[model samples]
Target chain A: MPKAPAGTLYRGREGMWSWVAHRITGVLVFFFLFAHVLDTALIRVSPTSYDKVIGTYKNPIVNVMEVGLVAAVVYHALNGIRIMLIDFWEKGPRYQKQMLYVELALFVILVVPDAYFSLEHTVRTIFGST
Target chain B: MTATVDGAGRPVIEAPRSRAPRPGRARARSNFELYAWVFMRVSGLALIVLVFGHLFIMNVLDGGVQRINWGFVAGRYASPFWRLWDLTMLLLAELHGTNGLRTVINDYAERPQSRFWLKMMLYTSAFLVVTLGTLVIFTFDPNISG
Candidate 1:
């Protein structure tokens, strides 16, 4: 007999980590976006001040935070898309595991390069290369 | 698009009969509903992967936290590749999430007008974000132009 994976909900369709993660990321992205809007709007106050504020965003730590921000937005968006498709299924409930595999593949394809570009850009700029 | 019957073509959106069917057939067995049911499952499954992979990478990867900035963003967006990557992610997420929410609204909202206006607001918001986000990603200038 196949052994069950740890952290299995013992009762649920698909992964519970995904569901909780989706909801949390959705809320987090929304809140962060609101703050981002406020920060961005600061440009209206004056360019230099705004740029200075924007300068703060250049900090690697802040950039790392953005990785989190982007991740949240990405996850929420992808899962939400997945959920939408499932809702359209003729028999989605029957093929959930297969769908899970598909979604995981899609996720990997999207995030890896996202993180890579983020790092590449940071490294290039820190070393003073375009 | 229109469905053709006999020698005539009729719009699918147009009713076969304006008044609809008898009480027993009001909710006829339908593939329309079946499609929507399937859409939710498929989208849900996609969301699971898109959402979790995003989390693990951002929150759990190298340094486990703390390593980002404008230069980081600028470096990536400087390339057309990252720009496209971002654009795809943005479009997919906005469309998927909003569409998912749209399904929820359709399921819950009873009144036609209520549904219409709610959807109006939701779509409006979604469109605004998609447009603005795309613009920001493409037109982004790290050098600050006045």
Candidate 2:
């Protein structure tokens, strides 16, 4: 058996890295969902309690984190479509590299405006504009 | 088995690789994995719409999270449409996330015991979150005093 091969389609390439990012972001989003459910459950406890907990989310730091969360979700959503196409579409695997580039382009196009809108309040808060 | 002489005059044994089973001879098994695969794609398509709409309404519109309060939540849950929307999003997102985490655990957890326990924990949390979220959506009292 040969000790090593010249190259591979997945190893250290766009496919592998995108898969890695998907897992990381998926985990991040899942954990956030768990906490979000708990916090939302506080509404049943009392309006005061729910508002108190939600108030923490209005802080500049947390707002920035929300931007990160949005970025993660957006990437996951777009890449998820890419993955489905790879599985279902006949020519998807043949052009997976091209699809990944398209996915990234769409991700940027979607997330830029989302990040700006999500962080606008944070910016205003930090710069004493509001 | 057939033997042939190589270039060095050594006898080479022929090893026949296992052939794929014929259609009727194929081993029977549950289609759980196949269903899970299909579910991921279907639920994912729905989630793209549900979750994006949710994020847009909650975090991007009307001054974003800064304006969200109990009143806003109450106002939303007052409508059956928003309640159903939230309920559907909650269920699908949780199930999708739980399945994703399950795949992650299966991939990374090297030991059987650790894998079992990790999945157990994941399922337990998923159950709790889904139950709690669903209950909150349905039983939410928008007019509660105090």
> RMSD per prediction, one decimal?
12.8, 8.3
- Candidate 1 deviant stretches above 4 angstroms: A1-130, B1-57
Residue-level lDDT tens digits of model 2 in B1-146: 55587789998876768876777646778898889888889999999999999999889887888899899999888899999998999999999999999898876787888989999999999999999999989899987755
What would the per-residue lDDT of candidate 1 be over residues A1-110, giving only the tens digit for each residue? 12445775345546666676766776566446435545544433445655567666557777667666766666666666666556557776666567777877877787
Which candidate leads in DockQ?
2
- How much lDDT does each candidate structure score? 0.61, 0.89
Worst 10 residues of 1 chain B by lDDT: B63-72
Docking class of 2: acceptable
Per-residue accuracy of model 1 over B1-66 as CA lDDT, tens digit each: 355443455434545656756766767587876675555455556545554554454344553223
- lDDT, candidate 2, equals 0.89
- What C-alpha lDDT, on a 0 to 100 scale, does residue B95 get in candidate 1? 65
RMSD score of candidate 2 (Å): 8.3
- Distance from true location, Cα of B123 in model 2, Å: 0.7
